[model samples]
Target chain A: MERSTIDLWVGIFVALGVAALLGLAMKVGNLTTSNIGATYTVTANFENIGGLKPRAPVKSAGVVVGRVSEIKFDATTFEAVVSLSVDKRYVFPKDTFASIFTAGLLGEQYIGLEAGGDDAKLQNGDKIIKTQDAVVLEKMISQFLYNKAAETPKAPETSGSTSSVVDALGANPLDNTTVNTTINTLDNKGKTDIAQPVAP
Target chain B: MIRSKLLTSAIRTLRNIGSRFTERIWRMGAGARLFGLIVVSSGECLRRPRLVVREVYFTGVMSLIIILVSAFFVGMVLGLQGYNTLQTYGSSEAIGVLVALSLVRELGPVITALLFAGRAGTAITAEIGLMKATEQLSAMEMMAVSPIARVLAPRFWAGVIAMPILAALFCMVGVLGGYLVAVPLIGVDAGAFWSQMQASVDWQHDILNGMFKSVVFGVACTIIAIFEGYDAPPTAEGVSRATTRTVVTSSLVVLGLDFILTSFMINI
Candidate 1:
């Protein structure tokens, strides 16, 4: 081959290589998706982060607005201090709730932000006070079993006690606080109603 | 008399083993010295960019067809196999992620290096060995020319430059091949296939690490080829033997280095 021919082919080869790397970066990799520019960092403390890893998505209303930058164990508080790199464009209220949530039935864990009604916006380096820990499957199952054992002795006294137990069992694990409160109210109402009938 | 003979034969066997071990270590030392000389004289290779470019044409441009063809077939196989398993778990949509991650993380760099070793590496060894056998390298030295700078350095730099490019092209082509098999052939949703891959495969972690691996493999394969050729006995049979050794040694070193690199990259 002539000198010019060799140079031309080498040029083409280098160009093709460069193009391929660009394609990998834009098309096959997360460079396009996870480029949250100009981020402000905020920290949240959780009693348990479960499997929430760094670089995990930080989503608000199912849309990723940031990423989990770092996770450190707070020795003083005995909690997980998770640093979130949220996009500067989206500002959250100071009282916003940060909770660890799984994507699907058995998927990776992420941090979800639920905006609360607060006049003040969360600034950079601000700590989110209202943070919920990840719901451990073992803990939820054990809690259900314990509730069942406690209700077994009073099963015969209530007319619609079985339905209440089913409600507790079917409650959403993600909304642990709301479910626990609802179950408590239902139990109290059942006890008061059964007591009135027995008085007669 | 029988006991004495047995002891003599045993001692002879031990001596043979010890000699072979020392010979291997001596060869390793010689190779390291050659590598140092190449690095020291790399300025000459860079000063004349055309020499490196010419070698790049011979090694990289020539090896393109085999690299691309093998990558496509490998990727298609990955898609077919991945879809077959993922569909059972109702996650056929994730076939793209599986293909992209595996290609970027392991297959692209490793397979490209293996193919390059078979194609360009053997050629380099044979060419250099033949030059030695023909006394051309000795003639250059007689003419006050550093053959390491004029010949081996250009080829070494060429291999180093070409490797990552070939691996990148391999990755791109492989992903396209997988896309063809998964989306149109197997009826996977194209959007989910691409979206999931983009969501999962981090560029810094996967793509850059893979490029780094290719560069390391390039250095290893090229250096071994050049060293073997330079060290070969100046004979026809010696040239052929050096070529074979180049392929074997390059393949083994590439695999071993890949494991070490992967372990280090994963921890990060």
Candidate 2:
């Protein structure tokens, strides 16, 4: 190939490559969405962050206002200290509630900020005190089971008059007592089974 | 007598293995020295921009068609397969994330490097090897010309410049192919497909890491090709063997380096 022809092709090749890179950055990557300008850093402590990663979105009212910049474990408090870089354009009250929330049933976690009624605005490096930790599925399921077990034995006791009615009608008073006793024992067993795993 | 013969054979095999191992180590040292020389004399390639441009034209522009075509096919296949699997979980929208992440993080750089090794790398080895066989390198030396500066540096710089661009093109094209299959063919929600991809694929993590990997692969592939050529015996058979070695060595090095780079780059 001639010198000019080779140069022209190389030029075209380089241009195409640059264009492709630009396209990737703009369309396929998070450059457009996560480019929150002029960010101010704030930190919040959480008991558990679950799967919340650094660079996860920090949103207010479903709009991304910042991103989680750093996640450090506070050894003294045994809590996760998460630093969020919120866009300077948006400000929160000092008492803003920062809660880790999942987008869907099985999705990545992000921080959601709910503004609180405070006279003073939050400054950079200020810690948000009212923070909610990520909800672990195992804990939630165990809690539900515990509540069910606690409520189960109470149901029969609340309807004690009905059981008494069975006795008044002379329809197997021993059977009624036995059924109530069995249910109470089963409920206690269920409570112990569910509570043991969660105690730690 | 049979037992003594067997012992002799075993000893000969051991000697052969030892010699081959030491030869490999010596070759590695020589390759490293050549790489250093290329870096030192790379100023010539920059000074004469036309030489590098010509080499880029040969290595990069020529290989574009293969890179683009394979990328498109790979993307379409990923889209079809990812959608098939993800839809079963009722998360077909995440097909975009799967396709984009796989292509940007792993496939784009790796597949492009493999193809470049097959195409441009082999060609570089064969051409330089042939020139050596024809005594062109010695002729240049007799005329007080440094072949490393005059010949190898431009090709080295060209490969380095062209590789990341090719990989980027591969990624862009691959994503488009995936989009085509997902949005129009498979009837995925177009908005969800793009939005999910954008949300998951971070620029610094996914894109830049991929670019870095391609640059590393480029250096490795080009150096292996030039080294194999420069070290080959001045014979047709030797040149042919060097060409084969270029493809095999480049592919292995690219894969091994990719694993190391991924381990470092991925944040757990």
Candidate 3:
């Protein structure tokens, strides 16, 4: 090929490489959506951010409007500080609430902003006072297990006749002895199970 | 008696293979010295820019079509596999994440390197080996021109640069192929596919690490091919032997390096 033609092909090759890089960055990697037109930065603090990394999409009403720009830990508050950039086109009220949501249940996490009905508009460097942290599945599972185990001790309180019935029925849903007592006493088991609220 | 004889023959064959592998490693070490010399002489490439362009046009531009086509097929297969497996979990939407991760992180670089070794690496060795067999390198040396600077360095740099670019293109094409299969054929939601993919794949971790692997493979493959060609005995049989060695050895090196690089990049 001629040198000029080679040069043109080389340019095309470089452009293709750059396009690939951009695709990887934008389509495969949720890099900041800041450069589309204009954007404003806002900060939020959360107690926990489970696997919520930078470049995670910031969605509002199930629509992506921005991205998480930076994440840092504040020693004084002991909270994870996340900076988000929202597009200028999509405006949010001052009382907008932000929560971390997981995509596809087990997939990557992103921030979901719930719009509030407020007259004031959130501007640059605006700090969102209301923020919810990422819900850790492991912690939730552990809590569930602990609650189950704790309810077992309350089961011994079931055999105290009416008082036991009251304690077991009133206190925990896991203890099934209360239902047995009701079955024995009321002679109408199905009605009792329906009448008593299962305390969990 | 026959069992013992068979065992002894097996042991002998294994020993011979082991010894040959060690001998190849020794030759590779010697060849690596040529790599060092080529690195030092690469400044000559900038001075003779046309030579680099020619070599790049040959190795990189020539290999582009095959690289793109193979990557597309590989990606389509990945999409089908991911869809079938993920549909069992009721989360076929994550297909884009699966396809992108597989292509960008591992398949793109490794497969591209293997294809490049077969295509460009063999050609470089054959071309240089033929030149050596014809006493062209000798004539250049006799004319007080350094063959390493004039011939090997340009081609070496070209291959090295071409590799990462080709691998990147392969990944891009692979993503499109995946999109075609996942969105239309499998009936996955287009929004979820791209959104999940974008959320999951890290720009620094997956994409950069893949590019880094391709660059290393590129350097290793091109160096091995050129060295084998330059060191081949001046004969037709010797040139063919060198070309074969280049393919096998470059492939082995690329795979081995890939393993080492993966362990370091992923684990650490």
Could you give the fnat of all candidates in order?
Answer: 1.00, 1.00, 0.61
Q: Residue A91 lDDT in model 2?
A: 86
lDDT of 2 by residue, A1-200 (tens): 34587788899999999999999999999898888789899999999999999988999999999999999999999999999999999989998999999998987899999999998999998999999999999999766655554544333433565454333334333567889999999999999998786654
- The CAPRI-style docking tier of model 3 reads acceptable
Residue-by-residue lDDT tens digits, candidate 1, A25-143: 99999898888899999999999999889989999999999999999998998999999999999999999999999999999999999999999999999999999999999999878
Ranking by lDDT: 1, 2, 3
* Chain B TM-score against the true chain B, candidate 3: 0.92
**Candidate with more favorable, higher lDDT: 2 or 3:** 2
The residue-by-residue lDDT of candidate 1 on B1-268, one tens digit each, is 9999999999999999999999989988999999999999999976789999999999999999999999999899999999999989999999999999999999999999999999999999999999999999999999999999999999999999999999999999999999999999989999999999999999999999999999999999999999999988999999999999999999999999999999999865
Q: Please say which candidate is ahead in TM-score: 2 or 3.
A: 2
Q: By TM-score, how accurate is candidate 2?
A: 0.89
Can you tell me which runs of candidate 1 are displaced by over 4 Å?
A1-3, A154-200
Each model's backbone clash number: 0, 0, 0
- Return the top candidate by lDDT: 1
CAPRI grade of model 2 = medium
Clashing pairs in 1: none
Model 3 chain B weakest 10-residue run by lDDT: B196-205
- TM-score each candidate: 0.88, 0.89, 0.71
Pairs of residues clashing in candidate 3:
none
